[model samples]
Target: MLRSCLSKVISPCQSAFIPGHCITDNILIAYEINHSLKLKSCGQERSMSVKLDMSKAFDKEAERCGSISGFRIGSRGPTLSHLFFADDTLLFGKASLQEAQHIRTILDLYKAASGQEVNFDKSAVVFSKNTDPTVRRSITQLLNIMEVPTHDKYLGLPTVVGRSTSEVFSSVKERIWQKIHGWNEQRLSKAGKEIMIKAIVQAIPTYSMSCFKYPDSLLSDIQSMISNFWWGDGAKRKPIHWVSWDRMCLSTNDGGTGFRQLKAFNLALLAKQAWHIATQPSTFLHRVFKAKYFPTKDFFQDESTSRPSFTWRGLCAVRRYLLSGSKWRVGNGLHIKIWKDRWIPRPSIFKIVSPSDALPEDSTVDCLIDKDSGK
Candidate 1:
């Protein structure tokens, strides 16, 4: 009966504590007992007859708390209570005493049940500029977590608010310079240098590049480093340029070494993200973006606001490339606009007519087809 309960509690994918693998049934029972105790301490009104499952309980409580006292980004779907990536966790809630106390209770319960304590010293609670200091202090004292003046690093990228792309990527530039200084350029052959440049040096700023369109100065700096290294330039000897950097970045079949142009590659990566946003609407990231930026409109039709995030600006900058290549395939003709949408397959023209020439503001392809017949 215990085994059956345990199996139900833990799925096959989460079978970390396998039976007969230095783990006993008593240990599993102890875990369930601990969970019940924690739940009781957390002010759960359930009787002892009910078995406590942490994951489901956590989700339920979080959802309830979020619905009551959370700042929601959109009017659609379930309110985002929390997000977990490996060991890192990000919790979202409205800045209120009730919400803070509820979060504290949940955290304490988790620690008691799992015997894994959160390091409050390492954790930080950041509030918006308009948030009251007194409320921030109260919440800080309640959670025993430090209050940060500004958000620093998230994942690996810097949490850029209004900073320039170059300022945000200063650390990446320093790292690349350090790598170049560490390597012995004279000792490496041309082929060896090319491999290192392509594999290591050029790949350094890829993460940042995917998110933001890099400045010309930064791209040129990186290109210069790779070019110098490839030509075996060192402290004592100066290297000669055999070919222009642009030509060198072209394909081998096009009469140059197969090297990537940083700016082009960065644009391509952002375009891929734009493509995903168009194709994959069910994804969480896609929904979040749709809610925040382009709610009630499609990607191409969405106009940029007076103030947009650096990442959003980057995506919009490369949106033209994606739109230029895209052509709509008429299915029901309800979704495609007659003049605005690119439905026709032609070399020079895709739309039936220009916006000025097209009549009726909300015209669609359905206007050309008979409603009763399946023409």
Candidate 2:
């Protein structure tokens, strides 16, 4: 009854809180970053993110908290103030005492109205590196929340992306090693190891893979670790590698264990994310990225070699795979060219081959169709 009532009463504008909503926790976290830090010096304007572990959510009064003034990503992007999650809320603002006080005031008002206390001890704040030490000290003192290190995470992902991406995600490797070490104790059969590798090991880096493209060296290192495990005995002694790892990655009908190759699988995961950004214009991620990266053009048409983030790089890197897997829908086919575009379902090239002279190279797909038949 409650769900049914919510379906009608809840504004269609909200993508959450009603029955059969597709806005998931993971999807929300994908937009958790406001993403505007360039490693400034002490005198520059500093930005900070405050993570609040709250026992509860808020009423419309919290929504009406007005602007404490959150930073914007691109010139055209929306200003993000705060994001509320199931267990925590992220508040973004400048590293000024005034901003900190405003945040505090908002929290106090919530505590007064909701009667649910915020876990201040569990909450913490992180600031950009270039922020003045004095400013950082003053804000934390004002808010009464501990200041976290620069590399602190918001929603299990790093808030600050430094120069070294490999170092940033080295934890993925560490996690895999720990899991493998624990599993090695079982002395499982070859069949069991294959299943574990497919299910658990591959899943470990998927979330990270969706955002950042791992360096080739790091991918090689991870592959080496998995390869070592597959070939090694339960003990320290290395067993002989009978077949190559590539061959083992083939399908059962192809005469090998059907393990997914990590690099390709990682690319596929990122491509899926890119696909969402391209197709789902209503998504917050699509709006944010489109504003920052491809303001004048579409996602596929963007080849901006400018100072791109790792997230943008990952999305753009999988363009080839995405293009290869996709083709024109051909509604009127006013836009698609016969020879230039990928419309045909054939292999090697999706474009029509044979004689380019039969139909002019500039001809659109609409030409060959019978006018009345619509074939």
Candidate 3:
């Protein structure tokens, strides 16, 4: 029964516990953050990066307090639920060590009010500069204190000890690609599928490269849905649009495939400072930027930004790609030159202007002139 309950709680594809009940806990944390931070109406500011540790929290104490809590103690799933106060926290944000220390103090107060003292020996605090080393040491210290058996899988399967970070990322990427290849093979292996295979071949460019924790069957269903939406019978066929490497990221827009191009997104997100510095006149960074890059111009005229020197070219490239598109005019009747004759409205002559020309001196009088008139 426990196995069944746990199975229901954590789906096969997911690596961690993510029950719906955690929403309130997350909301409370968000509330705490909002209460702690102060923001001006429209100023841009850089945030400090802080890493939090909460591995040593006591589940039994939380259960005694009457709040059900669940989390992957290490890296496994189904979450091993107890009381709400038992869950460990891992928070990372842009903030200084001093600021993080202040937040930690506040959290300790909050935890005490709720009848819990953070197991300090098993917990840790680190700034962005030392987070990796801090995390490794903290995890080792936490496992030792908990007396986790060498062979016992604490959270996920027994950790593959000594795997480097690159190895981990490579393994994850391999698994995702393998799943995609398996899915494609399954679809192509069916009988009477040569034509379907051809169609699938053509649609490969539009194939989603995004990773998801969905089961193969569910993913197949989603693909079928997309196929139907994009190429169903008797539908007007439109060209599939391809996205640039940067535009393909999910965070930039709502409708992108959930693929997060990590490095690209990081650069794009950082590029936000260019826009901020360009627009926010009152900020100290803006003043510095103006002085360094645009000594003669006011903030409105200053296009100078604090973006890293190397990224300026890529940023310009993305901007150009975004703007390079065919212009179309809307009309009452549309005409296809090759398929149908021209569709015309009431005939009128329109004068085109050169880039350097301003509006004609008497625009209304120009509109009144006959198309063929010598006047």
Candidate 4:
């Protein structure tokens, strides 16, 4: 009976509690909004966001409040009430008393239902500039949550991003340095060094690299550090330079140690996000991004000339890999452009090098497809 009555449980698109979603998804959504608005230079907005570090609380359904249903991300964006990334929840709305009161009422309802008080001390509210101070105080007083300029980090990733790329990401270098320096290199073998590099040092930037492309200078710095750790003995006897860093970054099949080049690794990591967006059309992330960035065209056709967020910028930068490496299946050639879209099963240019004189500008591959054979 339970199986018979089991309804399809649809998750809230805005929430990151759904499967295949992570804390990074939440951070990207929030960061992209501000970046599109050039918020880094202005350091402000007219809205406010409440980051609630709730206790070990279970889920409980509550009556919806129609008066204020959080805030709409952009004109075409979805109305996001709250983003639930694992345990963390961020609520957004206009910097107004009504919204604050609504939030307070919802929290009260939550406390009443769950019988657990929210940790307001750990909670914080970040606002955009030009938000009225009076309204801010009222909201903070009502919720009893302190106001903060930014949330900084959520789930080990930066919730806030600015123009200074290297400065913001300097902590990555610091953590790597600490790990490498703390180890006793004297007792380790060449095999042991390889393990240390692979298991520990190389894994340090996995999360960050998955989100943004590192600057060339930063990648060089990190590469130099890794090289030092690999070559330098425990004591200072002046380690000799063995092989070029680029050569070392080659694959085992290429007669090298298979070290990861930071730039290529970072791009590969960022490609994961691009892959998600390109393939997962039904995802909440796909919906949000599609509405704002590529309403008409798909991911591959998208231009970064639009006021792109840092996340989008990173994705756009890495998109070249997708364009160069992939092609359409051409199951039905109606949608595949003959001259522009990459559909042919050939190298480099996936599209065919057909005679331009015979084809129209809007011609598609359907003409060449055999209707009976379906090839």
Candidate 5:
């Protein structure tokens, strides 16, 4: 009976009939009933319940859904034809479950009349009232809905309700490694490495451009200094003293310049995203992704990744986070592929690597250096 009530069919070519008239009718009926009940109970008191109904909900339905909906617009773009093409909505009031249910029943009747369907699978009730736990519980009970975990990482950020800071950080940590084990050395590139690093750095508010207070002159000056010192005519094949700019280039703790390490910052930021994926499955977006992309695999895999998921592998700078110091030794020529096991030519070479080069070689993703070949 519910299925039949929810199912309605409308001609795709027909826009003359109002798109959501039936739904609006039901909402209005619910509102009227709720108002009548409140008036009868209070004699003169005001009802607090509010109801909202989507109007013209189906106007954009055809375009948003496109050919995926079993119909296609013959035109090139937005000029296409279909039902429900707009995003207008109606807000009403309903005081009781019975009143809301009455609207639902009427909506079903409308669908039956029009030979259309409501697609309940795509709909849900959201509680926008006060920050009362009772609201969530009540809506869940009334709608027979199960709350999906969304914003699991956000569960740790800040909240006006029940979650504690420890709980948030704990959740963040649990998911962090899931992101680590998923990075791939194979498909990354020098440019991609830079991009990933930048993204990760941008995620943390402290390192972002938003943190800049005055003019960006401070940063611009530092960049200019480095460029001059590293690439100046005097620097070209010229003898240099390491101590000259050591104070400006190193960490404050280490007696060097207090500049941000772009690569390290990027990995840390990407780690945050991994934390979200592993911890916040309840958030709607993650839940949807889990349902569609990773239904069976535990997001935090206990088994080794013979092949890492695309997202996990996308942030390939992760291994750098696990390494100590800024530079790593290259054991061979720059032809090694970090993603694959076998090196093109095993060069047992050794050379000093800087934090800046923690990313792959400039020309390739996996540059395996044979420690023996560097000499």
Candidate 6:
């Protein structure tokens, strides 16, 4: 009987007037009947329906928060509302009562639906250095959130501003050291050690390497640890060095073990980020970077400022590698600047001429083409 009813509701698209509507109607009817029957079986005279729906409410609130202007990255750019990954959420907005109230309302709606409460004691609100302490306190009180000086960790990596020095990555080194120490090196063979180093040790700092330029000293410390393990060195004693560390880092085809060099690997990873920024300009991260750093110019020509953020500096540092290999393929010639861009085939002289020798200050390749003639 159930199958027959279901079949009537769940027919071919052409057979039913509105295919899923019948199924939905049948399910609602079945639910109502089941609930009434249960109530009657319990000898209940009346029953009440309790609906717990907050997804729409939360979505509406998120939309409203996004609609309102928040913290701007530059003089003219898109505002940021929030960035979320799983349950880890970071809200960004101007320090004001209205923003605080909106956040509170969203949290309240979330709590009511999920039966999960927000622990304001643990949660904190952070403000920029330029923000006034009085205003910070006011916003903190309005949202009932604790005001914190700085965030130590976000998504496992440490949150930092300027260049990530050796001290900043000390904890990462210690964690890798601990992992290496915990292993039974005595029982593990040379091959086993190599495998462990490749699989585990190399992956430890990958996320950090992709974001920041690891200090040479930090890289050296990590490499030393990996080398000691590879050559069967104990906690105290030094082992005999058969092969140079450089040889082991080379490809296996070149009489080496194929271990990666940390510095080169870090550069390659960062270069990948630069590649994305160039090719995938439509991505959210690329858009944010373009707006803030290179708003009116090409990314390659972006001059380093005295106060560039650590992340921006790292990206800029690796951008030269990308620019050295890249050449512009002329289409309409509208986007490529004459002297600033590398549109020519010459390896040494990629630009048509030096900035000093170029005809006009702001001429593009389009100037060379004749508009009226086929040539």
Output the lDDT of residue 251, model 2.
98
Which lDDT tens digits does candidate 6 get at residues 1-375? 564575354322111243222222222122222222222323212211111112222233564537333444455545545443333444555556666676677777788777876666656665555555677777778777676655444545545533448887898899889988876456587787888889999999987777677888999999998887777645567766788889999998999999999999999988976676667564445555666678876677765454455566777889888988888988778888887788887788688664765467768788887887723
What is the per-residue lDDT of model 3 for residues 1-375, given as tens digits with 9 covering 90 to 100?
564476365432222343322222232222222222222112232232122234333223332332332222112212322222224343323333343444455556557766655555554332223224444345434322221212121121111122242332233344444444444444333232324423442233221111111123433443443333323232345425355423433452576444434444333433443454445664333443344345555322325454312222323333322222212122322221211121222233122222222434323333333557523
Q: Sort by TM-score, best first: what order?
A: 4, 1, 2, 6, 3, 5
How do the residues 1-375 of candidate 4 rate in per-residue lDDT, one tens digit apiece?
453323235345334335666656766776655443234234344677788887643232321535455555546667665666556767766678877877788788778988888788889998777677888888899989998877867667777667788988999999988887777545577788889899989999888888887888888988888888788877656577689998888888997898998898899988988888878887667767877788767888854455566788889888888877788987778877888888878777777676486879768899888889876
List residue ranges in candidate 1 displaced over 4 A: 1-60, 64-68, 74-78, 236-238, 353-358
TM-scores of the candidates are: 0.79, 0.78, 0.27, 0.86, 0.25, 0.77
Q: How close is candidate 2 to the true structure, as a TM-score?
A: 0.78
Clash pairs detected, candidate 1: none
| Candidate 4, residue 150: how far the Cα is off, in Å | 2.4
Model 6 residue runs over 4 Å out of place are: 1-60, 65-68, 162-164, 233-235, 304-306, 346-358, 372-375
The whole-model lDDT of each prediction reads 0.61, 0.72, 0.33, 0.74, 0.33, 0.61
Give lDDT tens digits, candidate 1, residues 1-375.
676567456422122343422111122222222222222322212111111112322334556445424334445522445443334444555666777777778778777877777776667765544456687788889877777653355445544434466776878888888887777644777687778788898888887676567888988888887777676556647678889999999898999888888889989977876676666575444555566567787777765554455566777888888878888877778867887778887756698665755468678887777877846
How close to the true structure is residue 268 of candidate 4, measured as C-alpha lDDT?
A: 92
Q: Per-candidate RMSD vs. true structure?
A: 11.1, 4.8, 18.8, 3.6, 24.5, 15.9
Query: Scored by Cα lDDT, where does model 6 land?
Result: 0.61
Sort by lDDT, best first: 4, 2, 6, 1, 5, 3
As a TM-score, model 6 comes out at 0.77
Which residue pairs in candidate 4 collide? Answer: 44-129, 45-128, 45-129
Q: What digit string (tens of lDDT, one per residue) describes model 2 on residues 161-222?
A: 66787898899999999988888888888998989999999889988776667888888888
Worst 10 residues of 6 by lDDT: 44-53
Shift of residue 162 alpha carbon in model 1, Å? 2.6
Q: By TM-score, who's the top model here?
A: 4
